[model samples]
Target: MADIAQEAGFRKNQKLKDALLQHKALSRQGFSERLFGLLFSGLVYPQIWEDPEVDMIAMELSDQHSIVTIGSGGCNMLAYLSRSPKKIDVVDLNPHHVALNRLKLAAFRHLPGHGDVVRHFGMDGIRTNSKSYDAFIAPNLDAATRAYWDKRSIAGRRRIEVFDRNIYKTGLLGRFIGAGHLIARLHGIDLTQMAEAKSLREQRQFFDARIAPLFDRPLIRWITSRKSSLFGLGIPPQQYDELASLASDGSIAPVLRQRLEKLACHFPLRDNYFAWQAFARRYPKPEEGTLPTYLKAENYRAIRDNAERVTVHHASFTELLAQKAAGSVDRYVLLDAQDWMNDEQLNDVWSEITRTAAPGARVIFRTAAEKSVLDGRLSPALLDQWSYLEERSSELNLEDRSAIYGGFHIYVKKA
Candidate 1:
């Protein structure tokens, strides 16, 4: 087995390494944290929660720009490639994520056509995925990544076999979503039916009649109270604490309810694949106009041609930024990773960010709280070197179709 530590990408930085260990140790507290840790240690997000379309608009990428981003499920990074940036360096602490990203990159490059790509990733119930993997994706993967997917489980099937079944229903987040469907079923709410709603009015009505009622259930409230239940959402304990602090009465259920409302009712169900995945556990059928930019038929060729521009790294953002020469990077996508950082870790990360950012460098990230974390956490001197695009950030935050995060922020390095 690949050493989880090395794959975690923390060993390069002593501070980050220490922070990771501390979180792991603290996760031993009780059944909740332990279970959360176990879930987090594996693939947490089957797809990224943050909207890459919002990110692409916010980043304003060009061939002159070099971008670095956190690779969660590798979806957004692949989506970002559609913009044809100079290069995209995708960093992730999870080896599974790293492997997943590499697999996606290879799939885009080696898959025969857009239909095949769609078949491999977009739809489920395909019996040819394993054969497709062996024929196309496997040869392109590095040995470590290949071994990770090739490893057999107790069921006597290689882990990659999941793609043949339903990749969307396989990861920690996937199963968590599946469990949610079960709960919805128990309450007589058909989440799949929500996907078929015709309009926002219909969506809201369905949410109110069928889905919203489940939020009031005693079991859901009890489950949401525990930090462990959110592991499937890819929320770490530290992030849970931040979310709880923002929530009234220190209960996360209300916050989750509000977010779910936005996800289900705020956007047209036909166009919002994020909501579809949450409610239905998969993207809309290929016939539906809604799909991630990377998956759309029109962008496939561009993504395939530019797929080589993405390089996956098993490292922290700071570690990757430290390796780049000063002012070499023009765009940075942090996701919600700062929510997991301590002040020291944040400083370390932003320090490298400032050091490597180009003249017009823009950094974009999401947070569990509705405000940017940089204001109170980082040193004023360091923070002052970058200008917060407050109005633009707020506008983009509103434009974020994902509707899961509390805030979207953008900062540009000052001239």
Candidate 2:
């Protein structure tokens, strides 16, 4: 574990090392930019970093063309299908994500039907809802996933037991919130009630009065900005460039605080489901507000049937691009995967994207910083082919529910 942690960029800080060794600290919150990709390749993440809704908005996809995207947790790919795309390809390096995607598909196809499937996945992940899991999902899982469910944790808890235990509450993002929970606890603020706040004004007051000050503390800022700290969040060595681009000097925690503050203060807690998922561990009830369309029970069949357009690949974006015809894909969604690539890898990806694009083919992606990845990365020849929809991207960005990514850029493939 020490080697694993250090390989992920954890410096040999005695306090952190001791904590990590004892299982008391589980995050690599402030790891440096260079070490992230190596650390995260297949070890920790079950999902990708960018939000899928944002990708769909930026891509402006149509059913006329095929869609290619990183699978991540496979959430957004399914979310994309909700738009009626002709086809969708979901690719990832992680087997865990592949397995999870299959699980979602199985539930969609076999569960006691749509509403039950929605309740199982999109609900609060609690509330004693064992009907769908037992009646349909558990019996339909593939052999490997079934075996995974059969295993037990070190504490002797069955893997499937996570449904009741709320695995939804402990993903990469979930763990980040858990860290914030610990930090908030240290400051004597019980954030769970922030969800009950009625208006943005009250929300702002809470952030200004309670959360903002946490960033001002020297110890907290120093610890959080360090490269060694972010590992606990499960960001791999390759993806650090995306995170570093979020701030000018490459500080992470301050931006994190700002985003969480925005999530809590920019919208009423009752209407913000992402905030509810993070802080309150529940979805907003229908009487309170709305959820993502994919979260609704009615969308299950479309999601399950659309699995044909969705293909999961154990490959990189560039590798898949090689198979696509020139100007073939009408829309492409690269979910910040380029940030994990070195110079050579990035060039290969963009060159292929440029080659395969049709006159109206649109390529969309999010980066860690406010600027586009093509700025200093792609060559002039390759970059000049597409029309940059900066203004349009920004307009669509306002509607994106996934508030995590930095900037959305859409490029129309040159005719």
Where model 2 places Cα greater than 4 Å from the true spot, the runs are: 1-52, 125-131, 232-253
Whole-model lDDT per candidate? 0.83, 0.65
**Model 1 per-residue lDDT tens digits across residues 1-415:** 3235333533443433444443444445434444445556677676888888899889987778899999988889888877788899999877678889898888999888888888888888889999999998899888998998898876689988888888888777898889999988888777888877888999899888887778888888889887777887888777888788876665688888888899989888888889888877778885664787789988888799999898899889988898999989999999998988889999999999999999989999999989899978999989999999999999988878889888999999999
How many times do residue backbones clash in model 2? 26
TM-score of 2: 0.83
Taking all chains together, each candidate's TM-score versus the true structure is 0.93, 0.83
Off by over 4 Å in 1: 1-35
Q: Could you give candidate 2's per-residue lDDT for residues 31-107 as a string of tens digits?
A: 24334433443224333445566676677766677887877666677777777788777776555566667666676
